[model samples]
Every structure is written in structure tokens, then in C-alpha cells.
Target: MSDPHYLREAEKYESPIPSREHILSFIQKRPKSKRQLFELLSIEDEQKKAFERRLRAMVRDKQLSCNKNGVYRPFSNRGLISGTVIANPKGFGFVSLDKGGKDLRLSSQQMKLVFHGDKVKVRLLNRKLDAEIVQVTQTVKTLVGRLNINQDECYVVVDDRRIKHEIDIVELIEGCADNQVVVVEVLNSPTLEKNASGRITSIIGNYLDEGVEVDSAIHRHEIPAIFGDKALEESAKLPNKVLTKDKKGRVDITHLELVTIDGEDSRDFDDAVYAIPSKNGWKLMVAIADVSHYVKEGSQLDAESLERGNSVYFPHRVVPMLPESISNGLCSLNPELERLCMVCEMEIDSLGSLLEYKFYSAVMLSHARLTYTEVNEMLENKKSKLRKKYKKIENNIDFLYGLYQTLRISRQKRGVMDFDRIESQILFDDQGKIENIVARKRNDAHRLIEECMLMANQAAAKYLQKENEDFLYRVHPKPTPEKVEITRQFLTAIDLRLDGGLEPESSDFAKLLKNASGREDENIIKTVVLRTMKQATYTPNNEGHFGLAFEDYAHFTSPIRRYPDLLVHRAIKRALSNKHRERSNKMVELGAHLSMTERRADDASRDVEQWLKCEYMRDKVGECFNGVISGVAGFGLFVELTEIFVEGLISVRDLKEDYFIYDDVHHQLKGQRGGRIYRLGDLIKVKVASVNLDDRKIEFVPVSK
Candidate 1:
């Protein structure tokens, strides 16, 4: 039968035709003439013209071959490929192939055919570095955009900057106003002849709205912020509080002095810790909320969490992976409340070497909920007021710090790469507008919690590796040769060496960071070294973690927020029960999907942060401030201001004093006349010249230093 994906093909085109897949499948048996295909696939007289276009397009894309007799067969060439289009804001894009290889670049002209995140089949050009779109198999159905009214015409400017086309709106919703933000339901994608068209589905108000940025970002990133009916129903069915039945066959640790240390503003507590001096060194118990117990693999909540991949944390809002009923209630380890948890108990030596570890299901009551500031103050001063106020867990905090000191030694010995970059905390005014931006300092208490989590994650990874289960490990591959060489050039230009010839170990990077300590350019040096390494991703293969310097690593903490951690929990539970499941095929797809969702969340969060920062700086035009060069490019320098953590750009054209030449190899700008050089990490003075809220851009001009 010459049938295709009838519903899908019908949705994609005005007139349905036999899909490339279906035609190819039919032709696999034997070559077919046009008349035979028309008769077999039931192509009518009116559809023949449209079907001919598809066939010709397929032949041009190298998906099929047509002989002198007009007979068609599958194309034997390997030039054809399928992948997702990752578009850039500059009107160009690249195809990230399904079978991994170098991404094929598409020119701006070719990009007009498809939107960002659309799945398409492409044909590699003769140069091999570029590709042309053969067909858009899947188009983005909905997009977030701002309504633009140009005289008699109305269109939507997509919030996702990568999608360059403005979708035309033939009909407007009743309340549509000029410059309003809206969600567009895509009707048809753009062709070479015309622009994209859509219908206004959601109205988010003006861009200046205090909370519209978050909503727009959620839609642009396709983040599932609203819970589906099925998911909500499932969540509502869950117990409001941990029931006695939930603790069956679990160890009772209610008497233990377990406490949670987190940011003061945090609501959902995923992990609680208790440490005691043991026979060898110390016994540390890390109790994580048992989210997997409630979010079963086949449940709607599980599907929702898997789709979300992880919690998306914006400045003040959070799109939690699990609903509030679970993430902030039953699965949350609140103080003085009994909660069911999966516990990782570890026995470490005085040198912070893991002697032994065990995992079990447990019911525990947190003795106290302590903030990081309070814990740090209590540890720094034995006679502090906060210490007296939290007297119940004072000794418990001491035990945790002692173990932290030992773990610090272990971290240094293992050559862990530490990138202590400045983190910004964005504040909002009473009216919900951005008030200020400030650096969020990391204290010893923060480090203590991080070390504890690291230890627990390592224990989990070791257990999974030993159990020989098909589980996801947080893997960090070695740096690419191109990035390493660029980093080496940058470091050498500053009279520093990265030590490693081509493939450097984490210890080599640690040495470079240690050498740059206390230098004026320390922050940028750390940033450069950090950029040289590849992004860490989850994989079924245990390729090890480079940043943490661990041979076996998996995300085992914060299961309530991260889907991978929940999966790890399930794998551990299954192993403990001596059950074997054959699903290695699914793990690879799962890892890739989780990685993509994580990236999507990060990009969405970053976009919201940028929008807020731009809003914060909108009124500061003409104000002068000191800034350090954080990023460099052919266009200009990205400068982060001193007191305020906001970033602005100093365009090359604004450098009127000199005709500067950008040296991408060494990441610097050299004056064509005066021999002056500007490099990343260099401190400079600049005045904010302009701020464009629509483009989310800030321009700066150099001020006399």
C-alpha cells in the first residue's frame, strides 16, 4: 500500500501527498513510474501538480533518484541528512544532525523557509560546511511574540530573536492593542514568496508589564509552566502529608538531629543532612525527598517531570518540574515535619576518603531549618546570637563543618576544577519592577552544603557503577582541540601557560587557576579556562566528570527539581530489589532529551534575566561607572559593571580614539596606531550611552580612566 502519515501530511500541507518516508518505503521494493505511484497512492488530478513538486523537491534533496523513464527509487547518496534547526538571531542557522557530526550551516536566505527548533531534512552542499533545506518535517506550532501594528497591517515580532520573520496576523482578537505581547498560533510557515502567518491566541499585555517577561520567556522556550488536567488530577490525588503507610519497611530516623541549610528565600527543601563523629572519621546521613515514590514511572506527574527535565528558576518565580503539591509539600523536607526519604549514609575517613557507604529508604524528621547566613555565622562565632537561637542543631552544624574541612582537602588532592565566578542576585521593587542587582556571596556554609551534596552524588555514582545498571552519569568530555588551542594562545599572550599540550587534565586547569589567584584579571582568567571545557551532559555511558574530577558521577541530589536525579533514584531502588529491566535502548534517548530540556530552561532563565537587567539599566543612561571586560568579539566588548552586576556593550565604532583590530586568536583588541591593547578581564570606565528595551541591548562609550 502506498499510504503515508495521513494526518501529519495533511496538517503540514494544503493538499496531502504521499510522504517522502512512505514513497521511499514503497520504492524500496522496486522502482515506480509516476503513473504507477499516482495510481497506487490514489493521487487525484488536482493533487498531481502539488505531488510533482514534492517528488522534484525530494529528488533535488537527494532523497530519491529519477531515471530517464521517469521511474523513481531511493537515493543511494549519503548527502541527505535529517536534524533540528538551531537558528541564530543574525538570520542564519545551523542544522544539528540526528547522527552526530559537525553542524551544517545555513545561509540567511535559506533560513527564511523554517523557524527555529523546527525539524527538517537537509542536503549537504558540495563544500560540506553548508546545507540547504529539503523539507521541514515538523514546524513550530506556537510562538511568543509582541504585536506590531504598522498602519493598516498587523504582525507579531517573535520573542525568540532567532526567528527573524514577523508573523502576519490577518485577523486580530477583540482586545488586541498596539505593542501588546501575544502568543501566536502558527497557521503557515514562510516561503520565498511570502512571510509566516499566525493567529493571536494569548494576550500577555504590554512588554513593560512587571511579570510579562517571565510569561513570554516561558512560551518562547516551550517550557511547560501550566500543569495539564491529568497531571493536576494525579497531584491532587497524592497525600497532603506523608502518611504512615509511606514509611513501611523504611528505617525510622526521627530521633536524629537532621537539619536543612539553604538560602533564606528557599521554600522547597530537597535535602537534609546530619553528621556525627564516628569510629573512622565521621558518619554523614544525606536524606533526599523520595519524589520517585510518589511520581511513579507510568504516572502523569512522571511524564510532566520528564518533559520539564528540571525546575526552571527565574529571578523570583520557579516553574517546578513537579507540581507544588509534591515539590513544595509532600516531597519537601520541611523542618519539624516527618518526611519519607531515600537516604545515602556514608562513612568517610579523617582524610575525607570514602571508607564505605549505604543507601536505604527512611522516614526522618528535620530537627531545624537553618539558613546559610545563620549557619556560617554560628560556625564563625561560637557565641553568636543565631547560634543561641538555633541551639538545637549547633553541634550538628559543627560536625558538618569539620567534615567540610576534610572534604576540602580531598577536593584539592583530587585536582578539582574550581571556577568561583561572581553570581548575581536580582532584586525587585515593591511594584514588581527590577530594583537592584547585587553579587551573591558564597560563604563557608554554602561550600559545606555543596561538599556534602558532592559526596552523596559520588556515593550514588559508585553504587550505580558497581551495580552495573543502565543509568545516566553526568559526563564531561575532554575539551575540543580548537578551544584548547585558543585558550592556550590567550593564556600565553599574558605570559601564562596552561601546562597541558593538547588534552589537559582537570588538575592542569586547577594549577592555572591557582597561579592566577589574587591577580587583577583572576575572574576573566577563570572564565576563559572554564569556557575551554565542554558542557557536561547526562549519558548512560560512565565517561566520568572532568569539572568535579570524579571518575564516576551522577546527579543524585535534588530529585524533586531534576528529572535525571529521580531516574537515578528509581534505578537504585530497582537494584536494591534485585530486579532487572531491559531498557538500555531508552536511556540514550532519555539522556539527550534531558540535556535539551536543561539547555532550554537555562536559555529561558538567561533571557528573563537579561530582560530584567535591561529594565534595571534603562534609566541609567548617561551614568558613568567602572566595569571589567567580561566578553570579547568582533563587534565590541561586553562589560559587567562594578557594584551592579548588569552588563553592557562597548561597540567598536564608539572607540573613536583608535582604529582597533580584533585579534580573535588571542581574544584582544589592538590599536592600529598607538599600539594600545584591550583584553578581557581589563578594567575600564564607561558611560551608558543608550538602552534599547525592545532589542534588550545596552550601549556604552569609553570614559577617560
Candidate 2:
């Protein structure tokens, strides 16, 4: 008696809701033809299949949009495409259209019609894969991470490893417990079946506390790390030093004895240097720390330093990109006192080339903050104390160690690769735990302050490309030929080749790391030509850098802690004063979303420092370590170890003396019954066996026979 075809299609449709306008006026017309929408509302073909089930349940609850050649349309005649969801770790998500091309995918059951940073309209259902979603609109929320709980329910999970969804946790905040992390907030969001309801909003700790690996790496890189009260009242109106009347007309360079160098328990000095011995030879200088002139450019301390696009550091703490009344007191360059910087001033020659450059705006004075083990004991010991503490910068740190041996011989005659990888550095202790890992030794004052910050970031990328400026740069490029034929079939099964061919040149991977220098398979073929290079981002264009070959590069020496080196210090103060400043198209869409959230905060701080170095070797589980076969794939092999540099895995069902398989052109794994192989620089031994830390993974095995 009721569904008389929605009462004869509500008596032939006309009440465009007229009880004195009860508002539902979405009228750019269009909607008629599911049989011409039940025969233009005239219903009755046996109540026209209940008036096509009340107009396909008002176009599946979005009140209207039947667009896949099924006509009907009307949600104010739809058409608005702003994308970015890409979900597939199956809670179904796919949007990626911020106006580029194609990319639409959708389907967590046709995206129960949209969630996950939603701002959709998507019409082309499939004009040969132009796929789309959110017919009208929904998810404008749901993304705050790290939860997992589990007692009276919990899940929230998303530290955006590309939105792989977990979501669920329905309201709870009493210091939420089980693996205690927290910070949820979502509230109803999934798509194929009820899930996305959250709450907890920050408990952030307990799972391995005490700076819980820096509050779980600033809550898995959502990175804000406290500082609002209008960014600590605009960092309490800045100023802590730099004065002599704000250094009367800039550039004093404090008698250019600039020093700094870093890391011996670094505390924010943000670059400094100085060189000398010129006349067809060396001048150098550098400087830095002006942090976009006390963090300006849309303040609340530049919106908490653009929501932390930099300064994370982790193992034991340092979230800071700004607060410490400006990154450790009015932008630290700390030492003698008056700071302010920005410099550069080059002019090298003894073949480190450059021979000219400028840039200015200064007022420096660091003169000794030294470290990298006291400039590698004053350049490999000349009876150290950095030569009786400075003695007027010991002939400018020995002409900056002969301009870092003429910029490591014009960076190995312009090819560069030298990847003797093994970095390490964990240590910790006084209650923060991890007491030792080691490796970090790069001496000669860390290659003379890394060749004077790569000659002041290739002279600030050729001084902002001779003023045709637009910023960011840094690049890297050159790897793919399928990762150089998977690094030439894993260095031709260790016989090792890399002698310029098969696209080699980075000085033929620096002459195959100087012929595998002092081998032990030299960290297994320099971690296999560093997993065949290319990962140095930040772009505005100039590609160059293939591991520092540099036609131009940038990161103008740190700008306190990198937001693309404070947009290369406001594009080197608008190209040293031609000053147009304009910028904002939402600052080039937030400089490509802060360079993809600083490469997802450096891959979630190297995945929580490889899950806290596999929970600091989970009490050395069954020992055995030597390791190597660093990855082969058909579901397992990986390994790595060699004195606690952890890495785990193995699992080709524990390679129990047979059935191995996965060769894919010899990156290894062979065995199908004792043809025994394993590959990627073999060396095996394994042992660790288990440490998931909720799938940050680790597990090894094969030591038996």
C-alpha cells in the first residue's frame, strides 16, 4: 500500500518543494532517463519499479548524479576536480587529480562514495580508465596517526604511508594504553564498510618512552612538536643578539674568521666557514643562519615554521624547526656572539674552479664551535688542540685543508659518486638507551666541511640562476635503466665491473669505489652502488645533481634547519635585492606540499630509525650476525647486520636446504633443491629471529647446517 511508486511518483513530480521553500534548490536542471526517470515522473508501469527505487535512492544518497551513460546528473550539475587520495592498501582510495591527468581509480566498494582527504566530484567513470569518485562530496577530515590500541576497540593507524587506512577506534582518551601512541581525531570515515571513527587526540608516548624515539618521531611525522600561543608569542619577539646597531650597513663578516663545523653533540650553529690563501687560489667564506630574517613570511612564526618542513632529527630529541626562541636562541651560529649571517663570497681557483661569487648581507663572528672530532683532530693531527686553539684560525684552517684538496679533485674530475656508505651513529645512554652502534668517522674535518658546503651550494645555485630566480633546486636524478640493470646484475655476481659503460660515469661510480677500497667486499659493493642512486629531491627545476655532479645545486648551507634552506633564504633575499617578492600562488602550492612533507619527514625518520634499530637488537636474540645478502625478493632474503646495523628478514620459508626460486636476472635466491645460492653479496649467517614492533619488521634465520 505504501510504495505506490512513491505514490505515483509523488503525483507526477512538480512540488519542487514548495511549502514556502524548504530549501533543496540544486537546479542547473538535468535528471531524466532511467526510463526517462520513470517516464518523466508519471510513474505507474506497475508503479514503475517503485519509481526506479526512489530514483536510485536519490542517486545513492548523494541526492543525485547518474553519470555513467546512465544520465540523471543534478547535484547542481557537478564538475569540480581537486585530487589526492590514492588508497589501495584497500580501505579503497584513489583521487590523485590535482589537475594533472587521468588518475581517478576509486573503489572501496566504489569508495562507499568518498573519504580520506576528500574534495571530490569525479565524473568519468571509465572512458577507457579515466576512472573517478565522490559524486557529490564527503571526507574533509580523517588523518592524524599512530594508534593501534585493542582492548575495548582501537585502530586509527595512518602515518600516511600513502593513506593505507586502518581507521576505526571509536572514542577513548584516558591515556589510551596498549602500545600507547595515540592522537586520533577522525570520527566516521571509511568507505566499503563502517570504519573511520576515531577520538583519542594525543597521548603520544608509552611505547618505549623517554623521548619515545622523539615522541614517535613527532607522532610519525605529523610533526608540529608544540609551540602555539601564537607560536610562543611570535617567538617572544625574536632578538637575543646581533646588534652593534644591527651591524650598521651589513657585511662586516666579523673579520672573516668564521668557524662552526658541527656534530660533536651539535647545538644549532647553522653553517660557517672561512678559508684563505688566495691569488689564483682560495677565498671561500660561506656563513648562513639568517633563517629568513627571523622567521617572517606569514608569521605565527611563519605558521609554526610552515608546519615543520624541517628539523626532526629523532634518536633522543630535537623536533625543533623554530622554537627555542628561534631555533635555539635567535637563530644559532653560536660562538663569540653577534650573529645574523647570510654570506657566501667565493672565488676559488686551484682547480676547485668557481673563481668568483658574491651574495652578502651579514654581521657574523663564530670563530670556533668546531667538532667532527675537533676538525678530525686539526686536520689529521699536527699535534691538535686545533693548533693551540685557533691562533687566528690557523692560517684559515690550513686554507680550508687546501680547499678540501681542491674540492676532492674537482669532485673526482666532475663525476662524483664516491659512496663509501656506512654512516651509523646511534650511541645514546643516560636513560635514552641504545648504547652503541658506531661507524660515523668521515674525518679531515668531515671532508673539510663537506667541501665548504659544496662550495656554498654551488654558489647558491649559480646565484639563483643569475636572478631568473624561483627557488628550491637540490635535485639528484641519473639512475634508471632499471636501476642500471639492477646495478649491473649486482656487480656481475661480485666479479664487479662499473668501469664506465652500461651508463657508469660518476667517475665510473668513483672507479668502483676506488677498486672496492680495503675490501670486505667494501660494505658489499657500497651497498650495491647505493641501491643504484637517485633520491635527492626538492625541485623548482634545475635537475643537475646526480649525486653532486652539479651543473647547479642548492641548499644554500642550512638556513637553520632547511625548509629548502629557508627557500634558499627567500631566494637569496629576492636575488640580492632586485626584490620583487611576489611569490604566493599559495606559495607555489606550499612549495609542492613542503616538498612532499620533506619526503614524508625523511621516510618517517627512516622508519623510526629502522624501528629503533630493531629495538636495539632485541636483546641480541640468538646472536650470529655477520650478514649480507641484502635483499632478493620472491618473499624474502634481505639480511644486512654486520655489527648491529640491523636489517633482518630471510623467510623464503627459512630456505630449509632447497626450493628457493626468485632469480629475476640474478639478484639471487636460486636453490630449487640445493643449487644453493641466496645472492646480493652472499656472506650469510643470520640468527635474530623476531622483532615486529607492529610490523616495522625484522626476523632472520638461516644459520643451521
Count of clashing residue pairs in every prediction: 0, 4
**Candidate 2 residues 1-705, lDDT tens each?**
123234444576653211101112322355454665444444455655554565555655556555546665555444656675555544666677777865767766666555555666665432333444545455644354566665566676665444655777767776576666666766666655666676777686766776555565565556677777887877787667765676766877677788888887778888888888778888888888888877888877776777787777766566777777667767788888878888888888888879788987888888788777877777777887658877777777878888899888888888787775787778878887788877776777787888889888888888887786777777778887778887887677677677666566577787777878887768767877887887777767777887777888888888677777888888788877888554335545665767777776776678777777878888887777787776778988887877767777878987777888888667888887668787776788878877866556778898864
Every candidate's lDDT: 0.89, 0.72
Clashing pairs in 2: 33-36, 33-37, 87-93, 183-202
Instruction: Write model 1 residue lDDT over 1-705, tens digit each, in one string.
Output: 635487889898887888888888878999898889888888999999988888878877777766545777787645468999999988899999998878989999999999998999887643436678888999999998889987879999888778888899977788889889999999998999999999998798887887899999998888999889999999999998889788889999999999999998898999999999999999999999998889999988788889999999999899999889888899899989999999999999999988899999999999998899989889889889987788888889999999999999999999888887778999877888777899999999999999999999999999988888878999999898899899999999887888878888989999889999998888889889888989999899988998989998899999989999998999899888878555597999999999999999999999999988988888899999999999889888999898898888999998878899999977888889998888988899999999987678889998986
Question: Which candidate achieves the best TM-score against the true structure?
Answer: 1
Candidate with maximal lDDT: 1
Q: How far does residue 182 in candidate 1 sit from its true spot (Å)?
A: 0.1
Q: Each model's TM-score, in the order given? A: 0.88, 0.32
